[model samples]
Target: MKIAFVGKGGSGKTTLSSLFIRHLAATGAPVVAVDADINQHLGVALGLDEAAASMPAMGEHLALIKDYLRGTNPRIASAGKMIKTTPPGDGSRLLRLCEDNPVYDACARLVELDGGAVRLMVTGPFTDADLGVACYHSKTGAVELFLNHLVDGRDEYVVVDMTAGSDSFASGMFTRFDITFLVAEPTRKGISVYRQYKEYTRDFGVTLKVVGNKVQGRDDLDFLREQVGDDLLVTIGHSDWVRAMEKGRPPRFDLLEEPNRRALCTLHTAVAAAYEVRDWERYTRQMTHFHLKNAHSWGNERTGVDLAAQVDPGFVLGEGLAASA
Candidate 1:
């Protein structure tokens, strides 16, 4: 299953995303953690030194990735015409979690965490050169394309720490995940994004659940419930362990407080239950919707081809490789 953590800038979404990845990894499950946020500190949070955590950025290798995923798909025309929202067709390559593929070999790194080995992939950070010349979406498009081509199965997980705030809605990337955990603090600024995200994704049939972060007492929990109501899936209290980890003095996952640990378990249970309900039909429709949206908006003009034709009429997502083979 694919899961995403999103919230306001200071709402601890990155920290929570790291904890969830470690929790899933400790269970000896196949998991991949992606730092899709512009800030890009998920590596340090997972206990890697700055140097080791800095794997090759996916953004820098867009052409290579496009070429590999495009495979022999006839509808795509060429790698140059493959936009970020392009869906895989009959002959396109599909990826499995931790699979030995060219894209994974080039961009993913294996790191040992508390429970087990977890693969880490990063969207790369906004460099100084990108300051005035580029938009962050161009860099994050790598993640969207990766998710588009990936076909994860049962017991396999992909956890993404999305960009802060509703900026995630800037592209079709927001619609890529199975579930999006909206991490909101007990602040107006925090829940404000939740409202914005809810409104943005309301018509899209997204399974959005709120995870209350930094809860101190009954009042904080009450505040979250008052604002979000039943949309709150779980609440993680303030943790000295997380604070210490942020300070560069990391500790064992077992040292985390009980309530926070339970919260993580609840999240895992929710995500696991979601795996049973993978809606491939709806998923394909969404992929097509965004592909057409992009094609009409800019892709056609840029590529001089009707990108909508790239969608394979009979191509099913999870069985793409088998069908193509």
Candidate 2:
């Protein structure tokens, strides 16, 4: 289960990425949360302290990772080059003000595998230099090799949270992900970005879905979901998540988690079934009925959502594995 989230900035892309990671972590699913966004908020979402990444710095860092793999000890790797992201006036100012080697403290927390899920790497948020010339420059072939090591070598699910714009720097990486979630807010331009991004997918065997995160209403939900394909459409709402960001605190899944958890579970199951339904010939002929079953399952869960809905409904709502997961 390799998952990635894409959407314009502030569309809840990072929040969903973190929520999914938290869920998988709770359910014993090992997950790698890749913060590919240049803004780099995934660490903030996960409540992990990490340094702001400069592409120049990242490119420099990659050189070290490669050299270290070859038995060279680079001193800069230990010097800890990093910067502060927290707004001033916060109480944490004194705790880490002007600290060097901030990378160690302000870096992606490789959360251990607790159950089966692990949020191994939370990354991205590089400076413009990372996007302008250096990130694309390819660090002596080390970047590609390092990326392959992350994608090909992972034994568990990997989730990538990419930068917000088009031009394919990050979207090009979509080909390797097992499943892709195209997130959109209510604006047509947002959905349009998702549509264009979808056109560039060249890889086969990867499933794509649309997630309507933080919708203000149902019209947008139905519009996004009705795009006419086998992909799953998951919708969530505006949450205390915004408040959490303002306060620099992590979202307690217990506090701001959504009613859509079961829906996502159903989605994960649907995707697995869709994958193993095996017999593309049979599936093509039967996809409508298959999709309709999923639609029914999804519809039931969408009916009752209050920021405070109890968990009892989903327990009865689950219908066993979509086809035996």
Candidate 3:
């Protein structure tokens, strides 16, 4: 399934995303981990090296896409291949600086990597970097290459480890996949924030689910149900395994930890079951919403998608704050 991990900052989205990557990979399916949060570091949580990503952003990528698209923007034509940043042996920071003048560059870079579509997608933050990446994506053949990777080549699963709080990937015009999950602490604000995303993504024709991360007490769980309707929401309790993982520590999920192993097992099962999701219709039956202003034009790489029809420039710009948050 096409899956994404989201929540307000420090709600364990990255750690959960990393664990999910291992969980899906354990099942032997190829997984693609896409890091969609510009500020949060999935590479650190996953223990990947930064040197893996070396492409220049904005300066080169944006221009490339604009030129290919026949745009007369001044930044589009003046360029030779710029210096590619070398991975820093730590994937947390790309050798290339983060400047998402045009956010399409992120998508473009991933597409250019041979075998970019793996069973797991280990990617970087979805930022201005993605703008230049967009330039690369303008070419139909390139996009087709990436889309084919997601489709026919079929990377077993796609895991987007998003930055906490608001982010560009999350704020984009339309939801991009089969399942969109909201993860939050059980605090009053957390509950409301979880619902906010659940309700917002639904506005764009995307399925949304709630996963209560670091949950505490029966009362909070009960309140969560009351707030989100309790149908299929999941509760992930506090655990040291998760704590250890957050500090770049290893063997985080020790079976001996009182409730951790059990928690991990239960959470893992929930993730495994997420593949069966088909909830877009059930959740949005009552809301009077339209796709975010530009929700119509965001990535529609999936087959048989007529993206032009979904173009909503205002919606797209409106979402920039949401995406960058």
Candidate 2 lDDT by residue in tens digits, 25-81: 766545556665656677666654544222222344553443332221121122121
Task: Tell me the whole-model lDDT of each prediction, alpha carbons only.
Answer: 0.88, 0.46, 0.44
- Model 1 — which ten-residue stretch has the worst lDDT? 316-325
Per lDDT, the best of the predicted structures is 1
Listing every candidate in turn, what is its Cα RMSD in Å to the true structure after a full C-alpha superposition?
Answer: 1.4, 18.2, 12.4
Candidate 2 residue 109 C-alpha distance from true site, Å: 3.3
For model 1, how does the per-residue alpha-carbon lDDT over 1-325 read when each residue is reduced to its tens digit?
8999999898898999999999999899999889999898899989988888888999888999999988898888789999889998777887888568788788989989777988899999999999999878888888899898888877889999999986798788888888999999999999899999999999887889999988899999999999999999999887889989988887888888898899999998888777777788788888889889999999999999888889888876873355222
Error of 2 at 44 (Å): 0.4
| TM-score against truth, every candidate | 0.97, 0.59, 0.56
Which stretches in model 1 have alpha-carbon errors above 4 Å?
A: 319-325
The Cα error of candidate 1 at residue 314, in Å, is 1.7
lDDT of 1 at 117: 88
| Candidate 1 lDDT (Cα, 0 to 1) | 0.88
Ranking by lDDT: 1, 2, 3
